[model samples]
Target: MQEEFISSKQNAKVKNWRKLKTAKGRKQQGLYMIEGEHLIEEAVRSGVYLEAIILNETYEGAYPTGFSTYRLAAHVFESLAETDSPQGILAILGAQSRFNAAEDFQQLLAKPGDAINRWLLVDGVQDPGNLGTIIRTADAAGYRGVVLGTGTVDLYNDKVLRSTQGSHWHIEVVELPIETAMQTLQGAGIPVLATALHREARDYRTLDYAAGAPLALVVGNEGQGVQAKLIEQANLSVFIPMPGQAESLNVAVATGILLFAL
Candidate 1:
């Protein structure tokens, strides 16, 4: 493997890697960074094209071979790392392709054979851990993809990435307006279900969704639930029954229940 060493935090490459910690910087550079051995392995297994592998000068662990590698000074690696305990390895990868609002929706609607049978739509979910957990759960439940609606946390956030436990590489994730996503799925003959406790909502278990039918479930913000407008637009509304004293479920927990039940 081709390798280089970077000892100065002031190096141009170090400066750029530091920029990847923010959403805006990632967007500007079309790249993001993932730390640790597991994520890097997942990226390789998933066929994600990695830009470069980064290592702390002192890291003793064996790293993947045949990729360009960079060894940084301990201080430099720590400065670039998001976690308190650095794993001594990280990698740069291209950002997932952004959804083309105008063209991609049309293509998705047109391609019946390529349609994902199950999708999770996230709206206004601000917590990184919650969003990541939701994605991981969706992957576990065999969902095909996740759509990140407006007000959702950035998918590339380090906390979010760590929370996913590498499931981020296993499923399709796209960002689009919630309304547009709903309309597109509905247009494609998929039923859109919004999670809410409105009077008209149905018990999620009561719904008779045919086996393998296309479905989209929307889970919203922790405090507000699904947006009223989105709930109104959904083909159906659903709620998990709670007989206990607890008033509600965590968004991630609630999503896992709904995903597996439906």
Candidate 2:
């Protein structure tokens, strides 16, 4: 089908894109805006429905004709896009698959199977940028999937989607309460790994990752790391071996290292 190109900012669809730019708007619409070429491409592959795709007049992207698209004037796209240097191609995609802790856990158990299903669990990582980058890195390192505990960033938030750069489509991100998640993983016989600052965390590399037991690598908040209750619940505490003078690696980077190592 030939895409119906839209150049006016007043178009109904464009107005919705504007709303998706804000956090409140995304929550209200149950959708989000993705502002770059690569991110949109990745989201599409991840099975997200592209309600509409907008492109700057200057960009020429290769996409299947089956997906609806709009070609906006360069000025209009720049006005709506959030990137520092907007690439001119943007899209508004449907949100990730929502999960009720009770329902989804049973399904995910199979994905991170017997041979040490390496997984990343996020507990209250609020900033969208950090969450998105962490998700993206998790995808690259081939972690079986991710679990989001309470207080974590909105997976469908536009900023998180942008930061993921399309990695969202590749991994399973399950959001649920910390306690519920712990029970499910434990019931399935998977070991849970927690990252802590000054506690019982052993060196990261020393863990035997190749053993193929189900594993969940948990990262905590920016200020407090993992919560006390959750930390105590962990089966293992592994610290990222930081030899430099710096205090710590950003949570996303730390997540990436642990994921890749596993």
Candidate 3:
């Protein structure tokens, strides 16, 4: 369960761990890192594929069994940790296997009795915090899954992971073409609701979301609203009726409002 102590920051293993901070490095290694006991535990509880666990030399805490554990020098651990207060516990996990959106959509529909009704389809959401909150909200609202379109922030980014607060382990998050995902879900009798600021958009409050009615909510970029081409594919377009004279809602806040509305 324990390995020889790692003292050098430039040690081969240490260098590999540091590489995870970059998207290119993560891609090349096909691995990502999760920090803190909570996220590490979430990864284990969710049955995520873990490569190993790393701890600081001074860490005297106990950890869950079943994975190889390594201890690094205090400085080495601090250097690898993204946060100021490193919990001295972290896990290296393989990137989640890619899901085929169309196939997953069909599989979910097949289980009509147990099918998840509300789905969040994200399009070009670039902010890691916004994307993370959206994922967490989707889980809390009991949505089935989240389909992230191209240009959405990487789900495994440390900031995004921290923002989710372990919600990523609780729900399905997949990346796929937005238009294709919309079409597949629609073909299965699910309605696609596009959040937009168009004249024809209906007020979100006027809608009633009944149990067992499958639907997908499409949200877009922080600055620009949903892309016009993507919105054109929605079964309906709706917007929050803000009477307070605010220009618009933060994408995450807007997503929370609309997600729970369903």
Q: Choose the strongest candidate by lDDT.
A: 1
Report the lDDT tens digits of candidate 2 across residue range 1-262: 5666677878887787788777789878888777776676666666678887777878876653566777878777877877688877777777777566655776767553422366788999998999999988887777767788888977877688778777777767787887688778878887888888666778887777665556787899987888988888989888887678998788888887887776
- Greater lDDT among 1 and 3 belongs to 1
Off by over 4 Å in 2: 2-8, 45-47, 58-63, 110-116
Model 2 backbone overlap count: 3
> Judged by lDDT relative to the true structure, which candidate is superior, 2 or 3?
3
Candidate 1: residue 26 Cα off by (Å): 0.3
Model 1 lDDT per residue over 31-122, tens place = 99999898888888888879999999999898888888999999999999998888899999998785748358647556554335788999
Q: What shift in Å separates residue 137 of candidate 1 from its native position after superposition? A: 1.2
Clashing pairs in 3: none
TM-score of 1: 0.96
Pairs of colliding residues, candidate 2: 115-212, 116-212, 116-213
Regarding TM-score, does 2 or 3 come out ahead?
3
As a whole number from 0 to 100, the lDDT of residue 245 in candidate 2 is: 95
For every candidate, C-alpha RMSD to the true structure in Å = 1.5, 2.7, 1.7
